[model samples]
Target: MSLTIKNLSFSYPDKAVLKNISLSNLPKGKLTVLLGPNAAGKSTFFRSLAGLVDADYEQILINDESLSELTAAERTQRVCYMPQIFSTQAMLTVFEVVLLAQKQLNSWSVTEEDVQSVDALLKQFEIEHLAQRYISELSGGQQQLVSICQAMARSAELFLLDEPTSALDLRHQLQVMQRLKDETQQRDVITIIALHDLSLAARFADNILLMKDGKLQGHGETEFMFSSPLIEDIYGIEIELFRNSKGSLVVTSELK
Candidate 1:
């Protein structure tokens, strides 16, 4: 199952966000990184694929079917998009919040399997004990994790996550990225994640799509941007790439 996005563009009433953007169907089972700085339309692009943000139907296709063919529920089932903004101030507990997502599995009813999966996800994130804790009571980082787990709990083939590690600490960030990578390989899921950490992106992503100002600046293999020019163009900063004694890629800013 592949996704095709052609000439997809969007704009707020006052500001144009995406220009003439087109990306081909990404292969199944490969991890792709949408790399961009702030306000480069990364989250907007994810929304376009999930059909949450309005777009021209002719431009967005999931599998061979147009995104227009899928109902809101159907789209939610096929694609899991972790939006940039999430807040649960409804006095719902963490477990309760997850249960809410499980409820999305079926419109009118929740199932035993859904509950079981919710339990599994809670445990997977090592937040099983916090299950009973109110979402309003959790720390910002903890809240972020619970929200992410809720998003991941959806049985979706395509996962579009926006800066999932932003709220996580270094260790949890690594854990989450590793888990996503492992799950994608195990299930052959098509995953697209937006990340600012180049090291993490280099370590896991099979393909990297670099964007600047709502335009694609680079799209290729993991090792394609070893040079300084491309990085400078997309990031607008001088950077240096070095190999550690252990031979891992290290990216550092180059001072003028």
Candidate 2:
């Protein structure tokens, strides 16, 4: 499956946020990093795909089916959008949150299979110890992981993560990205994540989409999109890109 966006645009009465955006053939089983500066409409674009925001043009196609044609419930089943932050004021445990996500509060009783599934998902993210803890008490990064677990519980076909690693420490950041990569490949799910960390994006992204000023600047493999000119153009910073001893791309701004 591939995600194809054609002539898609979203705007408010005052001004336009996304302009004539067109991206095509974003392949499945790979993590695509959406890179851009702040206020580049990355999050809004994710919302458009999630059916949270209306687009001026309805041309988003997933595997040749128009996303505009799907009902809200159908869209929810297919797409999972994890915003940059979430409200933690709800008095719910991590386990309960995951269970609720699966059943959507339709039933009061939680099944043993639901518990087992939630347990396995927590263990996969190494947050099983916090299963019984209240989500409001956990740290931001931990809560983000729970949100991921919730998304996983829903078994959505498309994952749209907005700065998923923003609050994570170095270790958890790597862990989350690696887990996403592994899951995307294993499940053949299309994962599109917005990220500001170029280094991490370079390392984990199978493909990269660079956006600026509500427009697509470049889209292709990591190697091609990580060029010096492109980096400088989007970020307004000079940087050097080179392969490490292990053949992985390393991005650094300092001169050696």
Candidate that would win on lDDT: 2
lDDT of 2 by residue, 1-256 (tens): 6999988898999889999999888999999999999999999999988888888775887767788788988888889888888899988999889888887555788889888888888999889999889999999889998988887777778899999888899999888999999999998989999999988998899999989888988899998888747867678887778899988787876432
lDDT of 2 at 75: 83
Clashing pairs in 2: none
lDDT at 240 for candidate 1?
72
lDDT for model 1, please.
0.80
Q: With candidate 2 superimposed using the best TM-score fit, by how many Å does residue 18's alpha carbon deviate from the native?
A: 0.5
* lDDT for each residue of candidate 1 in 1-256, tens digit (9 for 90 to 100): 6777777778889877887787787877888888888888898888877878886535566667677777887888888888766785768888878888767735667778777888999999899999989898888788889888987777787899988888889899888888888878888888999998888887778888888787777677777764537867677677777777987666777544
- Global lDDT of each candidate: 0.80, 0.87
Highest TM-score scorer: 2
In model 1, where do residues sit more than 4 Å from their true spots? 105-110, 226-228, 245-247
Q: Write down the worst ten-residue block by lDDT for model 1.
A: 55-64
